[model samples]
Target chain A: MSPWAWVLAAYGCAALLVGGYVWRLWCRYRHVSRVRLGEADG
Target chain B: MRPFAVGATAALLSVGLFLALWVSPPDSYQGEYVRILYVHVPAALAAYGAAAVACGASALYLWRRDLRWDFVGRAGAELAALFSGLTLLTGMLWGKPVWGVWWAWDARLVTTAVLFLLYVGCLLVRDLADDPERGRRLSAAVAVLAFLDVPVVHYSVVWFRTLHQGPSISLQGVKLAPEFLLPLAVNTLAYLALLGVLLAERARLASLEVER
Candidate 1:
């Protein structure tokens, strides 16, 4: 592969990995917040 | 995880990416591939910052014996591990085209690998310990000790003959061209902002777990 290919792949992988992590964190935050809210409502 | 902070980070990163890929000129020698530096360098710096935060929080935990400090230390360690993994991944990708090899036993690479593993071990120690308090104390100590590898990773290129290049931008002056420097600076700020968002969310999740 060309150098540009490598560069693009590297940046692409970094974006996916970091983005996935942030998404996971966001999901967990939402879940926990919902749980807490439910308990409050109860 | 405030909506405003997340939205701002996304917008900042979008602008940074646009500048890095489109506006910045290619390196005279390295050409377009040099764009990888925008991601690689920021990931490395963010990893180092996260590790430093972990080290400081670990020390605080040990000193005050507070669970809150332990929570903060854990969050920092997790982010450190994540960014370090990204650093190594991007480094290997960058290395393959430039150095003609994907992996090397050079001082900088080896030290960074060790640093990544050390934090992973810290996380394992926290997870596998039998008691919550015992786990926090043990992992706090591990976090502190693991941080000893950080300076080694940073100075490995200087202290030894290595395949890695020396620092490009430092206290002396900017080494990169103006076009490259601007995007690099913006991307670094964007990465730091992302780190802040991640750390805050992680800590909040951890606190919720403890309360439950």
Candidate 2:
């Protein structure tokens, strides 16, 4: 692969990982909020 | 926290970047690409600073069990990861033209990689624990220990065999040409300012979350 390709791949992977992390955090936060609301209502 | 501090940093960073990139002359040897030094070195410094903040905050949290310290420590860890990753990426880009290789398993690079992973583990461990307080204390201890590796990464050349070169700006008793040094200083300050702003915002949001 070309040098630029390598650089792009490295950056792409970093972006993907960070994006995945934010998504996971969002999901967990939503889940926790839902559980807390359920407990408050029940 | 103070508006003046943020304003001063922004002004300093803007002037610094201008001085480093535009005012500084290109290296006679490295040419245009050497300008990458302005970005690369500052990112590395910011990474170390962030990690140091994490270490200090961790220590405070451990000693006083303050939730404020814990939140700061968490912010530092995350910001440090961003800076460290950028440092490595820029370094690799700098290396390919100069070193003829994308990466070498040299001592400094290896130690930095380890440091990166260590903090990453710190973040994961904090997230995974069932007991929040226990997790905070344990992660704080790890953050402190992981930061100890920063010096090792910095001084690895003096301590071990490595293909990587030593300090670019600092020479025997002389510094690099003002042209080179100026932009580097600017970018460095810019990075520090950016890190501070991000950390303060993250900490504030975290505190608000806890209060709610």
Candidate 3:
């Protein structure tokens, strides 16, 4: 790959990694909130 | 996370990305590839900051014997590992074209890899322990030791002969032109904000786990 390709890949990977982490956090937050709400209802 | 914080991060990142890709002038020597510095350097700095926070939280946990501090420490460790992994991956990506090799055993690279591994171990140590309190204490200790690698990673280029370049921006002044530095600064701020959001979300998850 060219130098520009390498730079693009690097930034792409960084964005994907960070975006994935944020998605995971959001999912966990939703799950936990639901569980707590269920417990309170119970 | 608050909507305002999340919205602000997205906006800052969008602007930062535009600035990095389009507005920033190409390096005279490296040409367009110098754009990698905007992401790579900030990721490294954020990783170092995360490790320092982990170290401080671990110290607080040890001194106070509070589980809340342990939760904070674990959150910091997780984020540290994430950013450190980014730093290494981006560095290698940048290195491949410039150095003609994807991997190097230079002091800076090796020390950074060690820093990444140490935090990964910190997370595993918490999970592998038999008891929650025991795990917290062990992980706290691990977090403290793992942070010792942060300074080493930062200073490795200066302390030894290495293929990696020394710091470009420092407290003294930025070494890059304003066109380059502006985007880099904006991106750094965005990453810092993202780190805060992630840490808060992670801590909340930990709290939920404990409550359950």
Measured against the true structure, the TM-scores of the candidates, in listed sequence, are 0.88, 0.74, 0.88
In model 2, what are the clashing residue pairs, if there are any? Answer: B16-B186, B17-B186, B19-B183, B20-B182, B20-B183, B24-B179
- Candidate 3 lDDT, B84-136, residue by residue in tens: 99989988887677666777655556666888999999999889999989889
Question: Judged by DockQ cut-offs, is candidate 2 incorrect, acceptable, medium or high?
Answer: incorrect
> Which regions in candidate 3 have their CA more than 4 angstroms from the true location?
B152-175
Q: Chain A alone, TM-score for each of the models?
A: 0.85, 0.73, 0.71
lDDT of 1 by residue, B23-50 (tens): 9888775677778888988888889888
Q: Rank the candidates by TM-score, best first.
A: 3, 1, 2
Give the fraction of true interface contacts kept by model 3. Answer: 0.66
lDDT of 2 at B38: 71
The TM-score obtained by model 3 is 0.88
Q: State iRMS for model 3.
A: 1.4
Q: How well is candidate 1 docked (DockQ)?
A: 0.69
On residues B43-66, what C-alpha lDDT tens digit does candidate 2 reach at each position? 778887889999999999999988
What is the TM-score of candidate 2? Answer: 0.74
TM-score of predicted chain B, candidate 2:
0.84
Task: Report iRMS (Å) of candidate 2.
Answer: 5.0
